[model samples]
Target chain A: MILTVTLNAALDVTYRVARLHQGASTRVLSVAERAGGKGINVSRVLHTLGVDTTVTGLVGGLTGRSLRQDLALAALPEALVTIGQESRRTVAVFDEAAGETSMLLEPGAQVTGDEWRAFTARYAGLLPSAKAVVLSGSLPPGVPVDAYASLLRLARGCGVPAVLDTEGEPLLAALPARPALIKPNADELVATTGLTDPLAAIEQLRARGARTVVASLGAEGLVAVTPEGRWRARPPHRVAGNPTGAGDAAVAALAVGLANGAPWQSVLARAVALSAASVAAPLAGSYDAVLYQRLRDQVAVGPFTQL
Target chain B: MILTVTLNAALDVTYRVARLHQGASTRVLSVAERAGGKGINVSRVLHTLGVDTTVTGLVGGLTGRSLRQDLALAALPEALVTIGQESRRTVAVFDEAAGETSMLLEPGAQVTGDEWRAFTARYAGLLPSAKAVVLSGSLPPGVPVDAYASLLRLARGCGVPAVLDTEGEPLLAALPARPALIKPNADELVATTGLTDPLAAIEQLRARGARTVVASLGAEGLVAVTPEGRWRARPPHRVAGNPTGAGDAAVAALAVGLANGAPWQSVLARAVALSAASVAAPLAGSYDAVLYQRLRDQVAVGPFTQL
Candidate 1:
């Protein structure tokens, strides 16, 4: 089973309103809450696809309890470590009329040194039974900057392939550990490598020690630089829907491929299909099954070439 | 001890951000959360003033748990009834740059018949030991429209004076139950009475069955019509700050007056002083102690006569 780690797990709250008026009171028509974070979203997509996965992370306080309950409700297996501070929450306000969304992300609670030690111990325990481990999302305050690097080292020691999905310093710090794969979206790729060109960014990431670099270009689709060769996979068509979790959906496909040792072409094709299907669906970690099936075969996977 | 009932209690979450950009992700600089509701605010004010008070309300789910934990941390006594559904949350985003606040109110969980029954049973159990009770805020969906009326009747049956602070249909329904005092702001008074004049609105409210009507006219202070006589109390000068919980502070003072059987002039003076002092404070359920003490004597109180 693939183990997913979301160090900065969140109770994602979505408010549906007719419209948002700044500096005024808006009565939310509806509220939808779920356990959310990059790794958790990846696990959700994997679980739905009938892939074996376990969600492991740090959670605490009342918000943490809600997140755990939601994970249970979703039937996602979890071995979350409890901490002292309350977990953070991300509020997304969706304007029905404007068809737009705004978000407020709380800076998550500081994980103390002791808590980090405890989490690593738990992660080590879980690694023994894991085929592959995916470390995703930002490091909460007080956590070491190279948190993923440490986790990558632990996974490597256990002979488990690791997939790292994060951006900025944490992403940069984790690269020297040589994770099996890394998935960075277009913006994240540019930010991480300081390169505007996707192929160049992927190359830079691979040189830094990532065995495989899969960069997702929002509407453009997946570009992968791997040991096998460089390849680009484009979706059959652009799907109109929320694109928030499309990249995570792609990560789920890549992790599944990593666990099964699938070829680069098939893996990129599956990732692009899943990413597009997720866009067709309204919520993150969810995909349109019919669209995914139809697009899986239609996804164009070809050799990558810089124009 | 005064009893404050908040059927629609909330975990008030405040996000302090440099600025809010619509349809974009804003990273909150800080987050502050507290248990809140109109009645809870009244209880908080009363508690802060060293008054003997108990907070009674309907709270449920994880949000409720957080609310209760906050109340406990504040050292406010409570006998909250639990329900199956989660309590609501009100998100207030304070834009430091613009120096303004915007809010998103979750349409609290629907109270089932069983939950309402459970709440009334709890209220009934608490009323026998209470000197006075204050019912405040809006009713959640599925709760009977005359919920406050029922509570008022129970308070009256237990020989406890109740100060009802609500608007629209619930306020109109509870008026016939003859609460000891009803505090309505200028807009609520006008809406309730369908009259443009504050004095006329106060008269109409008393005519309906409220023993007294204390109408808050914002910076203009308060105009109270009671059995003793009509009186007006104005603050020494306008103190600019947040006015969110100003009325609740007045209700706190009114509930104290109802418990002590204070004269109308003294009660109105105290209420107006506390209201203005609350306006000078940043958060709801809090007051500027120095300002409150200063304003207590400086407030101009006299027999009110309509021009």
Candidate 2:
């Protein structure tokens, strides 16, 4: 079973409007709420793809309660550590006509040291039964920047492969632990390595002790480097829609491929196909199963070189 | 004691940001949550100003619970009626340097007929003990525009003075009930009467059976036309900062004055001063008592006539 860790969870609220007017009130045509966090999103995609996943995170207050209730309603497996502060909420105002998405994110509840300790202990307890652990999302307020490093250490201690999906300080700090895999988007790779080239950035991450590195390039697809080989995967065509959670869907596919013992090339191909299929779905981290199967065989994989 | 009704209540969340760039992520400098709705704001200001006030409104779900907890912490008198749906939340992004505020308002929880009947009955039950009832804010979804009119009918049935503070169809519909008082902002008056002239709009409202009409004109102060007399109260200077809830503060002051048996002129003077003081305060509906008192005596009151 896969374990996903989300330090800062949120109630994701999406509002559909004809257009977003700056400094003017706009009526929402539709509103939808769901439990969210980077790891939660990844786990949701994995579950929808028929993979078993467990989500663990810090949550508190009324917003936290709502998040948990929503997850239950969705029948998602989760282990939430209750804290003192309420979970944050993220508002995405989607302008349908313009196809622009505006986001307002709240810097969720602050987690105290004791709360962090409790969550770490809980995570350690669950690590033995988990085949792989995916650490994702931003660190909540009051959590030390090196918090992910501790979790990485714990995963190593339990002999569990861990996938680190985050950026900036936490991602930088966790690198010394030599996580099994690290997924950084183009911007995150640039921020971490000061290298605009995806190949150099992936090499920089590998030099920092990442066993494998995957760099997700929006429409261009993904470039991955593993101990076995370096591979590139791309979709046949770009699907038009919101690309918000496509990376998460890619991460979910990568986790599934690794669990199913797929090779580097096969994994990259499956990940690219799943990510593309997600863009075709209306909701984030969800895709049509039939479309996913159809596209999985069409995904092209080739050896990655300097270009 | 004064009773204030908020048919559509909200948990107002304000985020202080350096700047808001649409479609890009923003880091909030500070976050604040307050119980909000037109009537609730008035009640908060009234309590802060040492007026005996009771706030009655529809509340539900976790957001509603948070609102109640906040009110309890503030030691405000409240009788929040529980509904099936959760209360809505409003996000206000304040840019300090530019002195601009962007707002995202959510359509509040829908009120069922049974819920409306329950609240109306509850309001009627409290009428015998209430000195005056202030029906404020917009109607929630599922609640007809005539909801306020029904409340006004109940107030008239009990011989209780009802002050209506609303806009659009609800305001227009409640006017024929001949409420003891109605406070409409300059924009609301324009929309309701299609008249740019404040005096002409006041005359139109009075002609429609409203006994007293008070038109709030932000920096220009307030204009009131009553059966007894007509008065225009203007402050000596324009108060700085946000004028978001100044109108609610004015309504609160007017309710206090009427409950304390103040004359029409004193009500106008106190309302104007209180509104100016509210603009000076950080949170909406809050005012400096000393500043309000100092400005009260300096307010210019004169007969309002169309020139």
Please give the lDDT score at residue A208 for candidate 1.
91
Q: Chain A only: list TM-scores of all candidates.
A: 0.98, 0.96
Candidate 2 colliding pairs: none
List DockQ for all candidates.
0.93, 0.59
Cα displacement (angstroms), candidate 1, residue B145, comes to 1.2
Cα lDDT tens digits, model 2, B1-307, are 8899998999988888888778777667778899989899898888887778899989998889989988898898898899999898887888766667877788889889999888888888888888888999888998888888888888888777888999889998888888889999999999988998878888998998788888899999998888888888999998897688999999998887767768888889989999999998888768877899899999998886652
Name the candidate that leads on TM-score.
1
Off by over 4 Å in 1: none
Give the per-residue lDDT digits (tens) of candidate 1, residues B96-204. Answer: 9998889999998888999899899999999989999999999988899999999999999999998999989999998889989999999998787799988888888
Candidate 2 Cα misplacement greater than 4 A, ranges: B304-307
Please tell me how candidate 1 rates in CAPRI terms: high
Summing lDDT over every window of 10 consecutive residues in candidate 1 chain B, give the lowest-scoring window: B298-307
